[model samples]
Target: MISLNSITRNLDLHAQGNWLPIVVSLVLFLYALFMPKKELSWRDLYITFGIIGYFAWISDSVLGKMLDLVDFGNPKITGIGEFLSYSLIPSSLAVIFLNYLKKTNKWILTILFIIISTLIEWGMRKVGYMKVHGWSFFISIPLYFVVFSFLLPIHRKIIKCRD
Candidate 1:
């Protein structure tokens, strides 16, 4: 008979591989359903899509392939978990953030967003969802800041043009 410890480890590995993405994706879908309504204009959606595309390229092609800074662990969905966590969730949250946040609190929200993202990333590492080789969480902060800074003006321009 297999030892209890071995069975538990195998189950944990399987959960990380197959189940965690489903759980996270479900939570995001639910949050989207219940969040305070804002007009999701085509422009706003385009911005969200940009965020997703940009990060997907950065993480999958640039970071993972080019730089080799990190490896995603045990993703059951043919490596789509990398996109799910890096692109989909963040971009979705960015849409809500852009819609609901007051202009005066933009910087504050940005700071909070970075912190929360970093923590969740760290948690992913702890739970075996993400694996890092030469990457540090600290490196992501500035990169995120840069991406947000670059996107904010474009996002603003889109909303301005639309509304």
Candidate 2:
């Protein structure tokens, strides 16, 4: 059982934390470099990074603000930067899983991922590692469902077209 104070304290401590994301990115970069071209090429990895990063930035930063989903406790521009930074981990992992693992059944993956991600987030929130200002699993679950479901067929089409 986690406490709210602890969670808040942890989040404050890691408010600007970049270590995890940076380390993960480095690992992915290395894997992209050494892995066989057929498994995943450096070019495809870059594209994946670009697409996921951009979408996360737009969805969590730009649209989030427009919809009043979050605020950064600072300037709007800074809020956007913070959102992008915080979003990098999940977004990058998503791309890596999709590209490297080549698992096309994204609907199932999305559900599983969302459930695990949500539980983790909830636990973090309870421990003070995260603060959900305006969102909850009820909101996030459905949103991820729609987003990933839509992406599933698109990813399948892309892979089929490539082969």
Candidate 3:
């Protein structure tokens, strides 16, 4: 019978690194990029994208490097893969989330996005793309919840400033 131990062992043995992060980033970015920007202006999109990317970098640096709560990409070093994954994914997701916020119920969508984000992180860990040292899904869920919950308000603030 295939046990959890066997599966984990196989993963460790086959850890040739995968293209999941880049591919996922590309898909999200493409979808967000090609979609109609009915609710946000070009300036709003640019500002929010930069804000998200900057926030992601700072948060990851503290949590993953300083606090050692997480590890991304290779176990040994930080490189372009880690940087691009951190930068692009969150920025693209923010754009997509903001675009969708217009047509969806904010509360429901926020909760759903949090769940989905947590699952993606969990999958990344399971597939050897990430390692959780001092973190758990519990922490991640709340973090995502707060992040998504704030996104709309932040976007609105940007819009308000633009007017």
Shift of residue 159 alpha carbon in model 3, Å: 4.0
Q: Number of clashes in every candidate structure?
A: 0, 5, 0
Q: Candidate 1 — which residues are off by over 4 angstroms?
A: 1-18, 39-43, 75-77
Worst 10 residues of 3 by lDDT: 9-18
Order the candidates by lDDT, highest first.
3, 1, 2
Could you give me the TM-score of model 2 versus the true structure? Answer: 0.58
Deviation in Å, model 2, residue 85 alpha carbon: 4.3
Query: What range of 10 consecutive residues in model 1 has the weakest lDDT sum?
Result: 74-83
* Global lDDT of model 3: 0.73
lDDT of 3 by residue, 77-142 (tens): 655446666888888877777767744578887877887677667667777778778799888887
What overall lDDT, based on C-alpha atoms, would model 2 receive against the true structure? Answer: 0.53
Q: How many backbone clashes are present in model 2? A: 5
Residues 53-156 of candidate 2 have per-residue lDDT tens digits of 77776776653466665443232334322543445545555554555444565556677766755664454455443345676678877866665556633653
Instruction: List, residue by residue over 100-136, the lDDT tens digit for candidate 1.
Output: 5566777777787777667767777787777787889
Q: Highest lDDT, which number?
A: 3
- Given candidate 2, what's the lDDT at residue 82? 50
Model 1 vs truth, CA RMSD: 6.1
